[model samples]
Target chain A: DAGITQSPRYKITETGRQVTLMCHQTWSHSYMFWYRQDLGHGLRLIYYSAAADITDKGEVPDGYVVSRSKTENFPLTLESATRSQTSVYFCASSESLWSSGSPLHFGNGTRLTVT
Target chain B: GIQVEQSPPDLILQEGANSTLRCNFSDSVNNLQWFHQNPWGQLINLFYIPSGTKQNGRLSATTVATERYSLLYISSSQTTDSGVYFCAGALYNQGGKLIFGQGTELSVKP
Candidate 1:
């Protein structure tokens, strides 16, 4: 409740199904991000939100969707889960732009598996 | 788009040893950050050194924006320090987006 929190610590879904991961930050930061971590590629950003209702796609955002209806919550939805989409997801937030004064704070991360 | 590259893809060290990890960015960056992913898969921000030197305990970081590179120094590393270190770069006011390097996998043996 104090810092960033991610729901469904571990999840398993079937292909072609939809899954949603939730992220909530009590700090009410202005910036939020969603990233997926794979073995060889390290971590690639999925999407990021500047503020409430303002969202943009990141490097790998083809099958993912993100919505930030409120400043404290940013949720990522997988329209149709695929096997390649199974990876660890991390949610982060920051007060200002990413810098020493306002660095991004990360969540515990969610491990998702698609079968 | 900026590209981040890390050197010495893997490193092994004994306890109490010192190590330096390097990150090279392809282009100019206004913001740079270092993160440590522990054995438990927890990602923690070590520093946000955009263009200068900053230190915290045995950990210190330096970023040369002109050279498009950053260095992370760990002194007297412990077994608990074994983990993956990553450096990311981003443009100024780019809405909090970062291009992350592949990361350095450090293993400190006791």
Candidate 2:
């Protein structure tokens, strides 16, 4: 498909266990981002990558790690999932920066529950 | 960093009613976008109005960059329009990284 895809549409893991969320995009967009949504707080960015090897932290990056080894894929890892980390995770991508009229696109999102 | 704020945290409307949602940004931005998170949790892009106005079907949006705010209008609302509407923007120097607002939840009753 020519759109972004997220694996394990829904996931349930125990606290202290490690879980990885996978995201793949067919558009080869240069910028990829991971955001987690929760009640009251809304969607908070966790990490973003400008390229395969360039990544930066966003509003909420604690306890989470992200790596982009390929332009088409960006994965997020929770080293030790906590109950507080239970939320819906969204993966998004855009071509280049905001300047060229390229709007962001998001996958269906992954619902992660830590118990 | 840019801060985005949305008004009318929740709304309830009868089918065929029209309503408007507002978004305010803390500073100037290079990008502004509107999205609707469907009941199924899919984020669908509604508009990419950095400034000016744009319309699609029964939805329309207008961004007044100079004033640092945007507005989304939904006309003749239907049951399908019930969802969370979000507005996000990237700070001028921030490139494409978007900061999203808390969103306005809409419920349309037939």
Candidate 3:
């Protein structure tokens, strides 16, 4: 596929366990982001990668780790999953950082539940 | 952090009716985008209007950067339009990270 794809469409893990969500994009976009969606909060950014090895934290980066070893792959890891961390996760990519014409393309999303 | 608020959190419209959703941001933004999250939880890009106006099919969006707000207009609504509409804005020096509003949930009944 030419667009972004997220793995394990749905996941359920126990608290204190580690879980990794994978995101892959074929467009080779320079910017990749991970967001978690909750009821009142629309989408809160967990982490983002500017390039292959450059990454930064977003609004909500606590307890979540992200790494981008390659331009096409950006994975989000939860070192210790908690019930509060159970939410739908979305992976997005863009060509430019803050350009007007560059809009984000989101994946189908991964629904994670921590019990 | 900038605040992003959306109006009319929930809306129900009949097919063929028209509706408008509004998004307000607390600060100036360099990027503004409208997205439609379908029932399957897929976020589809609706418009990438930082300023000015753009139309695609029966959907159109207008963003007035100076006013710090954006409007998404959905015309001739269809059942397929039922979903959550979100607007995200990025500040000038935020490294392209966007802050999203709560979103407007629309249900189109046929």
- Which 10 consecutive residues of model 2 chain A have the lowest summed lDDT? A95-104
Best by TM-score: 1
Q: Residue A94: error of model 3 in Å?
A: 0.6
Residue runs of model 2 more than 4 Å from their true location after superposition: A99-101
After superposing the true interface residues, what Cα RMSD does each candidate give? 1.4, 1.7, 1.4
**What interface RMSD does candidate 3 have?**
1.4
The residue-level lDDT of candidate 2 at B13 comes to 99
State candidate 3's DockQ. Answer: 0.73
Predicted model with the maximum DockQ = 3
> Model 2: which residue pairs collide?
none
Candidate 3 chain A, poorest ten consecutive residues by summed lDDT: A95-104
Which sections of candidate 3 miss by over 4 Å? none
Q: Estimated TM-score per prediction? A: 0.97, 0.96, 0.97
Candidate 1 achieves a global lDDT of 0.91
lDDT by residue (B24-105, candidate 1, tens digit) is: 9988788788999999999999998888899999999999888889999999999998999999888865656777888999
Q: Could you tell me the TM-score of chain B in model 3?
A: 0.97
lDDT of 2 at B109: 100
